[model samples]
Target: MATVIISALLFVFVLFACRSAWKRQRNGCCGNDIQRLKKVKIKGDKCRDYPYRSLLHIDGMTCQNCARKIENGLCSIEGVCATVRLDQKEALVRMKRPLPESLLCGAVAKAGYTVLKVDFLPQSGHRSL
Candidate 1:
């Protein structure tokens, strides 16, 4: 009987936590879902036809600071929105408009790294927005 009560309490706590998260999401600050979700790196918006996101390989990302530097550099760029996973050694970028592949190649180069590959993201029918 005690086990059942504890389990029920735990379940209710989880439910409340989820509701709090939902309410926070509802606030909707920064940008809309479209701009946030419907973004790709190389393809941008114009190439709605062939939007692509890249897993950029940064050759010299030796540590978290290195990865953070790359993330900061890329994110500072006007059109670039980047999420970097240091453990993965990848920078997932979404562009405001279809940017030239060379731009990524160049910026990363200026930041002191190497570009491995850029893969186009297929509309999983459930990307971005």
Candidate 2:
């Protein structure tokens, strides 16, 4: 009886832990930061400050490789750092400026894709962390 009770308690603990991990993953899973180099090719004194992390919604990416290409492509753009996550088919960008809608959408289009939409998220003073 004691053995069965201990086993059941362990199982319950594992179930709880799994649920917590699942919730965290839903928030943002398997994301890596893209760090830009310290210099830019543009003429002297014509540069933007370091980028800020921002999240955006991108549509039209279909697979893992497609997502990777999107990340690389977006990162290649001047003044932007991007991490593309395929699970949710979304691109999270850290950008020096609020990207022009045409700029981002057009790149994806040139890559033989289309951007269905983009949503901007503003920073808030509160973080539960």
Candidate 3:
């Protein structure tokens, strides 16, 4: 009787695990069924307004929702505007002022993603007319 009960419990556990895996595959690793996320608009619309720019290579972004989450996280910072490219697994981040690398990494990390690298781009010479 004890062996039978143990086997049944193990079978139920396996069933639950299989169901969870199916959900992840169907709804993405983030488990969000929503296809699109609400766009996060930055204060400055023009590229010239942001003098500083950086590229972040991120990992663990499985879908558009993950990209949007990372973008939202970085854009939440003051003076920061971020656009994530899900296919490339990178983000182009622009800021009005220079921010520390730690801050940028922290933002991505907050969204359950890992920042593998950060490359600072040369300052843009374009000025607002």
TM-score of each: 0.52, 0.51, 0.86
- Per-residue alpha-carbon lDDT of candidate 3 for residues 43-126, written as tens digits (9 for 90 to 100): 756655788999999999988889989999999998998888999999998888999999999999999999999999988867
lDDT of 1 by residue, 52-125 (tens): 45557667665555565576667667666667676777887666556777887787777677878766454322
Which ranges in model 3 have alpha carbons more than 4 Å from their true place? Answer: 44-48, 125-129
On the 0 to 100 scale, the lDDT of residue 97 in model 3 is 92
Q: Pick the candidate with the highest TM-score.
A: 3
Cα error, candidate 1, residue 87 (Å)? 1.3
State the TM-score for model 1: 0.52
Model 1 clashing residue pairs (backbone): 37-128, 38-128, 38-129
Give the range of the ten consecutive residues with the poorest summed lDDT in model 2: 31-40
| Cα-based lDDT at residue 22, candidate 3 | 95
How does model 2 score by TM-score? 0.51
RMSD of candidate 2 to the truth, in angstroms, is: 12.8
